[model samples]
Target chain A: MSTIANYGEVQRALQTDTEQILAQIPVSPVTLSMPMDGAGPRICASVKRDDTSRVPASVNVVLDGNPVEIVVEAVGDYQDFKAL
Target chain B: MMVNEGSEGRGGDAEHFSRLFEWLNTNADRLLDDPATNLVAVGIGKKSAGRIDDDSPFCITGFVEKKLSEKEIASRSMSLFADAAAAVSNVGQPKSLDFEIDVIETGSRFRARPGLQFPAAQRGLRGGAAPTLDLQKRFETIRKGIGITNPHRSYPASLSVGTLGFFVRDEGGTTFLVSNNHVIADENKARKGDSIVQPGTLDLTQSELNLMPTLAKLRAQLEIAKLSAFVDIHFHNPQAIPFNEVDCAAAEILSDKRDFSEIARIGLGGDLSGVATPFTIDPVTGEVTGLTRVYKAGRTTGWTEGEVTQLAVVTDVRYGAGLARFRNQLGIAASPDNTGPFSRAGDSGSAIVNARQELVGLLFAGSEMQTLANPIQPVLDALSGALGAKALTVI
Candidate 1:
């Protein structure tokens, strides 16, 4: 079970495992964000749903002796608010 | 059906006629609902020519959909005369008080009659005239979280709408409405001194469609309504700045000095102070230190709540043919308790506030699931440089 008590572990994942994963991804649009779902500051990478590339549903990156979770979501492109 | 209190001698008769007018107007709804009456419209008018003497010419006129035969009229109890006579007698007036009901055949369907000055006989009575309301003043009072837009190109053509984000004041105390450049400035299309209409162009079009019969007339009325230009917008698109910091503009409100300074539909149990300041962010973590939840009152959504789902987000947003890239933006997802999405199309330029009602960001873009806002402090700083204000502070 992952708890929010490991801020340092999450930071380590962001600097190391998250960066390496982003650098290797072939998708055109990918963003890193933090979702507060009681799991504290965790990384969520949103990718465009239309892309043919594949993304892992969830990845646990180990920092020191602790594991941090990174979530990937497939979403539609963002457009400015002009009624279509 | 038109009810007229024919032109009678002025004296005690005036009160009688006034009473007659009041009765007819009060029963208008009942008259319309009764199929026997066959009344399509009601108003005060002169009695039919030569039907009555000039001294007593005014009567209550009822425009029937069609001319009914005497037999049909009688069968339907379409007797305004007997009704008025009975009404006068009820009030202890002389039974001889001869008010009239002139049933005319319009021979056409009567829709809403905007042309009719006083559609109801009651409107012609004393104390009937309402105080002349400055409708334009109501429209010109630009407040935060309401619909507003600019007329960049032509009438009814280039009518795009968005929300007024919030209000800001310069060091000199001049108040201005802060919204997206796409909203007040039309994404770099509108010029200085261009009209920024409230309720937006779409709302104006819908209003005209309901009131005006013809498209040409609607366009004309829209042209007159263009006078709702509430602010003189100042914005700039610097080709030098690599990436846009905020999709924001400041428009100095041009209306009279009446404190229009308020946000719509939010108090948060005394959390709001009529002033909005952004939340502080951690420099190293790039996280809004204490901001957990957010809220907004927008043109479309009215009021909504969401959780901070993303921070320091860099996304490429589509703006018609061009794409403007924004960085360091806050992303929000609809709160679990919200009934619908956090934001919608017309919700752009809404001020995103935190649980404490502190201003957090200026919402500019979004998808069905996520809403994006430019952090508030950066938006203020950007507006300051563009509008040449020493500093801009939310009021």
Candidate 2:
């Protein structure tokens, strides 16, 4: 197998782990992309939670000694994130 | 009167009984370490209806290896100290002040039992997620042992006061109210300098705090280093360290409005609100040393007392989404006769103090049978190291 195949195996494993986590948690789900240089995983999600619950500012998942940040969707001009 | 004679007759007996309790407490570890004694619990008790050890009731109940006769216990009691033998071998008749040892079923260390009814405190990640109880009113007073809430979580729910715990000072003389991170920090969902409301959002109704007399805000949530040595995290997740381990938080409370020194109903660990007890920390290891009986006032069960049953306990706990493991945690079980429990769901963030009034541990999480706390020494160190707090002293 080529080096690219090895990276693919690791990425697939992370996706699998992410799936397992999502099934257990009440979180907005998304895939984090690992950089080709293996610097870290960058996370972005266009997910919105509609529950009446006040959610956390950001959720973090650690991939390969680095963090992938999951930002809770932005709502309106009522920006209390800095205060909360 | 007959009562007066009874009391006067065993004056010396009661004194001995009292001293024996302290002796037992000091030697608790030794006693428990041995299975031969079969001693599970020991506390002062009333005179049983038929038992003769009434004048000085010292109930010694446990899973006796064998039903120890009064003579055997008297021998054991005499073996404890030289003077104790005199109480056992009093001429013709034995004074009823010997050992009233009763062996029965096993006793367990009490954990704060949680009752989750409403979707708020009742919400869980998985299976045990059934709504069994109903939304009910909680305490209104701003003191310890009353229910509090973190409105910042977006879901207003009730958690216990866990005492006002302590008043920590920054370099500028600013004081902050302390509790578990889950309580004041909303399980890592709060910003520093934000408003932390006492009586929480779900105490009485949506606006119970609005109608109440004292309204307090939890300032900004302060962070502490997850005692990795005290906690167990699978993957190196910096985020999990703040959310999961050591379960403590502090928000600046205006001293003019509410007193951090004052505990809710129970006065500061026996009326010691303002006075600060000196505690010892291993400068090298950051561990609390030489701690004894500790107390905490919570929202649900009110004032509770127990001994540090175990120390340096490492275990995993579940937050909303996942499991976070912690290490170097202190173990506290229910007091004898079930007076105080370490923590329940609402009981998180209570201050655990010793008889000397030293801040010993911070009550954060637990099973229904026992509670766990992060040692206060390391917690205070974490504040200064990670959160920029210096000269952290309890007011």
**Native contacts present in each candidate (fraction):** 0.21, 0.00
Q: What docking class should model 1 receive? A: incorrect
Looking at model 2 chain A, which ten-residue stretch has the lowest summed lDDT?
Answer: A75-84
Each model's TM-score?
A: 0.54, 0.43
Q: What DockQ does candidate 2 have relative to the true complex?
A: 0.04
Per-residue lDDT, model 2, residue A47, is 25
- The lDDT of model 2 is 0.47
* All candidates: DockQ: 0.15, 0.04
RMSD of 2: 18.3
Tens digits of per-residue lDDT for model 2 on B1-395? Answer: 01112432365666756776765576556555654454554444443423445444444433433454557857765222212222233422223434443344434543568754566654564446432221123322234434454454453233323333444667877656666666666556566655555554444443543444232232222111111111222322655433223556666655444444433334433543333233333422334446557777666555677766543443446555455555556667777855434555566766777776656777777765557777776677766554565667665
Considering summed lDDT, which 10 consecutive residues are worst modelled in model 1 chain B?
B224-233
Each model's TM-score for chain A is 0.49, 0.29
| Candidate 2 TM-score to native | 0.43
